[model samples]
Target chain A: MSDATEKEGRGVRAVETGLSLLGLFLDSDGPLSAADLALRSGLSKAQVHAYLVSLQRGNMVVRDPQTGRYAIGPFSLELGMSRLLTLDPQITASEEALKVARKLGQSISIAVWGRYGPVVTAVVQANDQLLNSAQPGTVYSVTGTATGRLFAALTNEAEAREIAKLQMAEVTPPRYVGACPPFDEIHEPLETVRRTGVSITYSFPQPGVTAISAPVYNFSDELELAVTMIGPAEEIDISLEGNHVAPLRALAATISRKLGFIGKASGA
Target chain B: MVKSPERQRGVQSVDMAIRLLEIVRKESQPMMLRDIAVSAGITSAQAHTYMSSLKKFGMIEQLGDAGRYALSDATLTFARHVIRNDATLNANINVARSLSAEIQEMVTVDCLVQEQPTVIFAVQGPRTPSLSLRPGTRSRIGNSAAARIFDAWSDTPEMNPNLSRIIRASGYAHAEGTPVPHLASLAAPVFREGALVASISVIGFPDAMAPEPERPVLRALLAAVSSLGGSSA
Candidate 1:
């Protein structure tokens, strides 16, 4: 390699070493001292300290005077907030939702947790005649909708109970093709969702309309949104192991991965 | 210019990279290639090499048609860990949120950063009108109650002996209608592990938040401070 290329190669290694030091903070339970970092990284204490001082000058890391341990600082906070600000889940999942809808010949809707309950933020119709109530900005009833049951099942128990009880008071029971359980008896359906990792509503909101929903998670493994496949009851299979259900689950996991989720096994 | 001790010990490439980052942060705006090179006292070609390295690391990026470089959100992953991993700051932020909700007044938590009191967390109370002291807002010693609380507890020569004594005796400071007319604030120092670490304050109208011992707000503020083991000092 030429002299210029050799110098550039060395510069890349330095940047990689600095970033690896910062990356170590992500794994640590709390603030770490230079000695702790040196142990974790296999670098000498002096080398770690020198790199840390440079990182500190950039406000990439901050050293506490009292404990002499280092933590992430303000500059990184601004960058992180900026990244969060630009995350439009609706936009991120729209193309994938549409692709899945085409593959399965079913309509799809994306739902996010709103103040009231699960609120539908976007929808992709498989065809013109796919009559469904999954409209943009429509708030799904926790005791009434498939997307609602998914959130009510997976969220913190206390919060899920509150949301379930709140919707029980606000919405009236919808007529079902089959004899549906009373609105107050929602525990069984929510339990099913928790066990199956998906929710199925069979022709409750509208006669001949059935929908199956699964959750999409963010980097933190928190339930960020729900992706639901909607269709006519006769055409859609609502069983957990049915042909359509597995694809829906796979699609949800794919979108979750795109959003930086890593907790779940890939393609599981 | 003399090299600081840190510069003497630090890696040359890492130092150059940080100097560029500091320039971007201080400018608070996207900068062109030549400008950054001139400020760092390096050639444009040399600046380009460092800038390329920073971009590859996701620390900085070029924006719009101008190709001016600025900090990127790539560092947010690291930032998230930084904010989440600090136990003391994290616990106090939770306290600030709950106390503001319970009292229906804007609550702010601040600590000394380079001797200036800087707000690290703030929750607006429902009852209080708008207050501008968001996170990262800074104040000098005499500007606000949080700043004064830090000054009172520290042994710096600029510390007022009488004010320090008063604050130490009461465990809080009351600022009534001085910083902003008709606005009042009551601040208490937060101590952890037997050392003064931060200050928490409630801000609102003077009538609702009077600076008196009998006032329920003062009692509540003291209660919140004690719950955190912050009243030890």
Candidate 2:
């Protein structure tokens, strides 16, 4: 190899080893010791020691005083937050969700279709009821909740079927099999939601709870998020003509508009 | 300028001392001199010499009666200095400070680092006790509000799908008197673009943050986060 190539190769190897050491923390159940890192990274304890020193200098890792295991340092936290700031949909939707929740005296959840399913991206709750509602980062089931139904209505048929399959597998306590509807039964409601552009469900996923969800579109007019309003069934009216439906639709529309949806498309 | 061999040797000693510090930090617990020497690939005698110098500089300290060594307060001070200077952390700290002042409750900004929820910045409210707002504290992902937010938004697979669903539906996590006694915490996620970046939490005594009073605090926190996030974005 040329001298420059050799120098670059050495640099890449050093970075690889350093990155491998950092990667170990992701799979670790807790903090890792140098010996543990050495054992995992296939590096000698001495080499691990040197790498640890470099990581520490960069503030990439920290040692717990009580456990004596190396954990991610504060610098990594800074980087993680910086990366999260670039997600425009979450920032825009979250601000709107908070405002709607306060105005309606209900809980609002904004969810995006994640690889796992519909993952909640943001949530805001009005006080005086359901203070312990769904939190951000929670995932919704395609078969069980309003948000899920909304996603099932908007998502592609093949992906929706895959989510449905996962949901079927998720129904625990085989004896409670009757509680989870068959796939065919699920399709009817999803089809209705797709046509109407809104989903209102009661006593589903949880008893005595009601949820109303509408879709938010992005610049491409794809289903980017679902905004849902949830509360107790007794207090929240889920009827088509109820007080919450119009405002909920309006909020979802407002967010969709913010996302550059001009409302030209109907199915989205 | 070329250094004299003596000055070069001095620089090597400083490097060795830093290596010793790294070994102690890697263990995550206090380490004995023999173990430190073995980890650093130095003799116990050499390790002792380096430890003495590091202790003199307040970078390392000896535990009582035990000959074990650990990073000292000075090391944490250095870490705190880095946190203060970091751009993202500085902005979060300012938002946390303003929120704390407005709500009169301790506010913390936590992020997922190495898949662990760790606090990077904290501002204690006037009424809150000094004991709780330490930066760099870690909480269990399943139990704390901040950890739950990180878990819910992170691409990592969920540990409990049911809990994740509930947290997603709720939009915020609340743990009453958990991770700390007599302290209840409610945390909301702060997003940038469409990704969850961090969680801003308000912690206070349960009675002080009762349902009625907490409404305003939650509203203020959401408003503060929205404003801060808008500016930062």
Candidate 3:
């Protein structure tokens, strides 16, 4: 419960009830009038009317004369995006990953180099004909999944080395070397990804699977997240057949630019 | 109809004035007093009083002619401010913009109102193909992708039983022909400090969006939206 809610407890049920009324108009096709709103919220006619009046006063609910209804005000959008900007990497990457999943018809996932090597915080799976579904909080073995390798490869040297050290310490028999492509070979894909600014893979994590991953740029040029496409081997062909690579690169690049990553030096 | 009865009682003046301002706002240039007054629903006599106050408040102003009022730049600034200061619904601009370009489909941000669902914001790319999407468009609550996501997130922390089921099972919501007919969408809730806050969604037409994987996409968006909610907040 919010501290305010906790503090008010039952005393402020009206505030909670009022917010519920406001929530209703947030997506109302048009502004809502106090009477109809009262009917919908099941609140007493007087209470709903009072809340709507108060809402208009606060600019949270707008009274549109043309339609004579109340809809959301500009303040609502501010609240939405303000929450959006806080976690730049996740929102940017997940939206892109959904595209990859939709196109590839396979599970696509996003990974970030967190304190625990590469963690798969988000996943989008193909609704049909799939294996290896992606789930949030599903941690990839540093050497475990393509999304993992992609992020592992993309990290700056120092972070990569540390993650590798962390991985080797955690995994039995050590993933520091052979299990994952040797740090030296990992660079080939990593550099290809960095230089070309896109990451691609085939049959990673398991046989008959191919995937593509890309970096997400935030309101700044800083590398915030990665988007990957995972799919069955045959379906992977469809992705390659289309000009998917170029669009993915362009898409990722555009997001980067929007995040204020305008420098050509980091355009890749 | 959406405005409360309390709002109807005496605030019509304030409401009409805001409407006149909006009428002036839609066009690139100033509008004549008749047009503004017609839209705002006040007599030219009553409008004169409202306009005078609006002008002083910097919400509207006279252009080349004394009777012509145009939206002032201050309105846009105020819009940006109102959008920012408002409670709870997050800005879907960059996310929607990026999704439109990236997905090559209409991207929308929606919220749940009165436990009903509808689209609050719709951003379409020049390339986005859509039959039913525009700014301020309306849709059924909890019926479409954007609606489902918004419904999921906007649920009070006390938690609606249905919403809790959707969030726990899928982490987001999905629907094929909800807010818009034949439009496909995958939507995810945005959470703030564990409370559902707003929603983000990607939309496409029937031909473009096959349903099987849409749920996963919703899940992915949910995780990311939560992150965005954290940092953006």
Candidate 4:
């Protein structure tokens, strides 16, 4: 019998079926097809398939190349990452980011690439009443900032330049974000990131806030992700450009290892 | 890469079940039980039974205002386990064999099933005596490079909480064959989307596999796996 026969239920049947199919993935280790979804969701096959096609086009789902089963995709990853950061990106990042925030006294932040410049993921607060309220889920701009260069490195020159344009157009003073003078300084630092494999920036996103940013790597020897800690000038380590780089570098490397990059020794 | 082990004396009901699934995969839209039965060369009664069970598992979906059947999202899980590990062995075997060449040992590719390490395939060099570690034997997740690779590839947050850190710190791992002390093995993890899913290992007698160009061999082996996959998550 069709679910429509039930009292007080009609269109809701399919929506419930759709949600139930997504729930099945929690029990499954891999992908699932329409049939699997129907079986797991206990809905009529037609209703589930329709919702899936719509989900696929919207980037809410991913189709497996081999099995033709569907699962969560990049959009989901972005959402998942956002939620994780909200719960204290510092905790998700674990001990080192926490340590950096505490030493600095000014609020410290570690951010990664999100739709906005850098999405502040983890944060360590300072004692001051000024209260820099940049929360974990907040997105920062690539222009006129430290994490900006790291975000720039995520893409090629053209993409960064394009991002710079959009950012400046949206902010005050209305000039090219790339035209910011500090941006010119980033070219050399980014090159160092590509070479020596780490980067450091001064008085980063906001003036009076100095920062250090580093890339986490693994056995693959690829600079796939970046981590940055930003805070007020007094608590920031200017010596870090040389003396403390290894700590941040080591922390990034450790995070990279945890993320499964394990570098040269692992066959990469 | 190794295919799933073929089953023997499999149930007639299971065969019909698979055939029904295939029909849905091939069909453009939902098919009624009659259509499914005809396609699978079975009676409608049998097809109805299969469909009833399949519907319970989320593998098949019903379509239209009326009841017709098609594929659903759940089948991908079964396919991923096979497909993900397929490349793990294919791109890795030659590299593992070549690495084994310098030490004149046996090279093998392995994966995990529920953390039970199993040799999926192996190639023994001429200098070494043929080893008994054949494909399809399940082993402990401890004491082998292959196990480390499997644990590393797993997405579970606390995979191998005891040794994961050590394996990460050390890079690649070595096995003195705690499972079999005479056999010394070395393994490296293959990562995909930032998770370790497979391992390639070279194994042989400790005396015969003396320290001869092992690092270069593993490096070459790792490079080969990287060619087939992204370096990190």
Candidate 5:
């Protein structure tokens, strides 16, 4: 290669190596050591160390003083939070979700169709007891959860079929086979949810938990977000005339209105 | 992509030092020189040279006399700079300034950072008392109103259950003579999507925050929190 080309190649290689080191944190359950990163990234320990020092200077990663292991730093969290704030749909939905959650005394979550499936972008728990119900950045299966099913129902036919195929591929043996119903069986329920603009499931995704999800539309009337209420099955009333459904739908409509949707669907 | 000649120019030792920092950051515990050297794929002598330079820059710090190394406050300082420029945080800072001016008391916006309640923004009123809290100050979670609000809203296992319950129920927390003697503070949680994003607080002498929850400063503080919480974008 030409001298300039070779220099360009080296520059790109350096950035690639640095990015690969950062990528290791994505799969790690906790902090990682240089040795751990070297093993995972196939970069020599010396190379990894060099990149890490640079990263630390930039505050992209931080090492615990007590433990030598390194993890994502405050700058990384700031970057993530900034991005989340910029997502108008998430911010709008979250505001409405917080109001509904406080009013109804039930946890609320906002999910958007993400690369893997329905990824929860924001969550507000009613109290300490429901702390573990859901959290931001959790990706749920499209066919197994209320938020996922709502997204599936709103998506195009080809994408919906792909999601169903992926969900079926994850099913195991005789027990799970029956547990995850056939695509044809779920299609009718999804159709009903699409017609009604809401989806409610009990003992799905997990037992002892109930979830109700309603679609939020943008100015163009396209489904952009799913507002969900999740809680313990015993405490969450999921019937049509129950306490949860009306308010849940109303909250969704409120969010849609905030997004500039002028549809006549009265959530009140 | 076309590379500028400047892109090719980089300090080799600086790169080596960064690599060491990354190694230390990745490790779960403080790392010994030998382990750091082995992980960095460098000799112990080479690693020692880079570690010494990193330590000089406060990028890495030695753990006691054990010869183990970990990151230092320099990383947090850099992180704080990023947070200081965040849009939502900046907007909240404006709110803090207005609230401080209205109440004639110190106002602050505290956010959870690395599981600790850290002051990200602060505005001192004209009549503010003698207190030294500034941006980046970490307050005690057990006793401070700002910290307690975060503890109450967070799901972290380290939170005090009883205090968290009270804060959750009341939507605010008040503390007297905590973090500092003779100081009183009231704080309200800012919720976004049902999660506690930050806490807005007003601080003053005990008398300024007296009469329990009926003080005007407290009302103004809650109003500021409400305004922040109601922001859709």
Candidate 6:
């Protein structure tokens, strides 16, 4: 190779290493110290600091002056929002959610698989009363809500199981009003969803609320988004074959087709 | 020629790559190579090198027959990571969601982003209010309760000479029927480690949302803020 090509390769490698450091923050639970990053990324402490200084300069990472720990920066968020503005799933789901909310007269939320877990992207409240718990940017638990369980059931299993395990670990018993379900226990519910193509949770994640959720798939026949319809528990029928589930499942199928999911119709 | 002090210290290529990415970020449309090159004041060949690295990482995408480039999926991944990893933001978002759920009123979390009071999170009330604010909505200085809360607690310049004094005394700011007709809002500051970090605001109709210091809505708002380690007094 020419000398110039070698130098260019080194430059690219530097950029790649710097970006990998930023990627670590995505997987981490919170802001990380330089030493923590160095340990996780398998780089020397001094090398990690050098890359952090570069990432910080680029506004890819920010160091809290008080704590000296690094977190992802706002510039990255602007870039993310720019990409999300054109995302096909969110746009289609938001429109479809509004329509479903209008037709059914219930609050609806559209959740897509964000980097962390299922993050709400759009919410359409019914006209009569408010269901304010689910808001855009709220990340649902993989094992907790209907929207979350739908995604957890439909997506890749190992990743879903891992996320479920972490969430179960974090859950307190008091929140469940009893012993929180064991990590292995979610398998049965998820398996049922895989067979049924819909997930339901009664008065969970919020009391007096029942949510029925279905999945939207992309061209690759992969789970792309989960559309959940929430209403008062006493009013919403919890049966898998009930009137409420039919419209929600139908809406998910319609959205899936719009997204080019040509596999056998969902919930089949 | 000597490099500027800012550019001289960090990795140069990473700096250039971020600059090119920012140029693409600022444009609404997918930009051609030459446009990005011109925007960054770099040669097309030089810009191509950086663009190649960014595209390799899925940070920028070249689209269609024209080869116009735009920010790509990696940016969203990074953005979500940033949003998720910020412990304080997540706690505040939880407070907004639960408070709105509890009070049956719209609640929002606002913070000063780049010196502008911006809505970082919002939860809609049960009863459909006249105005529904979305995340990323920027609040103006004079009329909004959030702006007033920031002025009262943070370094933002006070809009009213006595506004900060009154808000400081009351431990919250109230704006009624001004920013939008018939809308009333109560906003209280949230402090983490004694520094004003955000404002939690409840907004709704005037009849249901009277701006009283001892009202249940204001108490709930203050309680939520206090749970975040914010002192209302």
What residue runs in model 5 are displaced by over 4 Å at the alpha carbon? Answer: A1-268, B1-19, B22-43, B48-77, B156-162, B230-233
DockQ of each: 0.27, 0.03, 0.03, 0.01, 0.02, 0.21
Model 1 ranges off by over 4 Å: A1-6, A30-49, A56-59, A62-115, A120-132, A150-183, A191-268, B1-7, B24-52, B55-58, B61-74, B93-189, B192-222
What is the C-alpha lDDT profile of model 4 across A1-268, one tens digit per residue?
3332342133233333443555566556556787988877776786565566545543446777687778764333222222211222234355555665555444556665543456666666645635354567766657555566765764445556666666766656542222244345567767765666555566644566666677754212333345665556665565655434656676776665433332432232
Provide the interface RMSD of candidate 5 in angstroms, 1 decimal place. Answer: 16.0
Fnat, model by model in order, equals: 0.42, 0.01, 0.03, 0.00, 0.02, 0.45
Between candidates 4 and 6, name the one with more favorable DockQ: 6
- Model 5 lDDT per residue over A102-124, tens place: 98888898887654567787888
The best-first sequence of candidates by DockQ reads: 1, 6, 3, 2, 5, 4
Q: Candidate 5 chain A, which ten residues in sequence have the lowest lDDT sum? A: A171-180
Candidates ranked by TM-score:
1, 6, 2, 5, 3, 4
Best by TM-score: 1
For this target, which candidate reaches the highest lDDT against the unseen true structure? 6
Best by DockQ: 1
Pick by TM-score: 5 or 6, better one: 6
Q: Residue by residue across B1-233, what tens digits does model 6's lDDT show? A: 52332564677778777888888877879999998989998767667767788888879888889999988767756665665566777688777878877887778888776566777666555453546365556677566888888877766565776878888887788888745887878898877767787888888877656667577888888788878885543
Model 3, B1-233: lDDT tens digits are 35544545533334344455545545555677777667766555555655666666444557564657764323333333333333444345446555555555556665543343434456543344534343334455445665555444442533467765765566655667655576666666665666655567777665555544454444445545655654212
Sort by lDDT, top down from the best: 6, 1, 5, 2, 4, 3
- 2 or 6, greater by TM-score: 6
Kindly indicate the candidate among 1 and 3 with the higher DockQ. 1
lDDT of 1 by residue, B1-233 (tens): 63443565666778788787767755656899999999999777778888888888777888779899977545545544655566676667677767876777778887765456766556655465645455556766665778778788777835569878888788888777735777888899888876888899888888867878778888788888878864453
Q: What is the C-alpha RMSD of each candidate to the true structure, in Å?
A: 7.7, 23.5, 20.6, 20.5, 22.5, 13.9
| Native-referenced DockQ of model 1 | 0.27
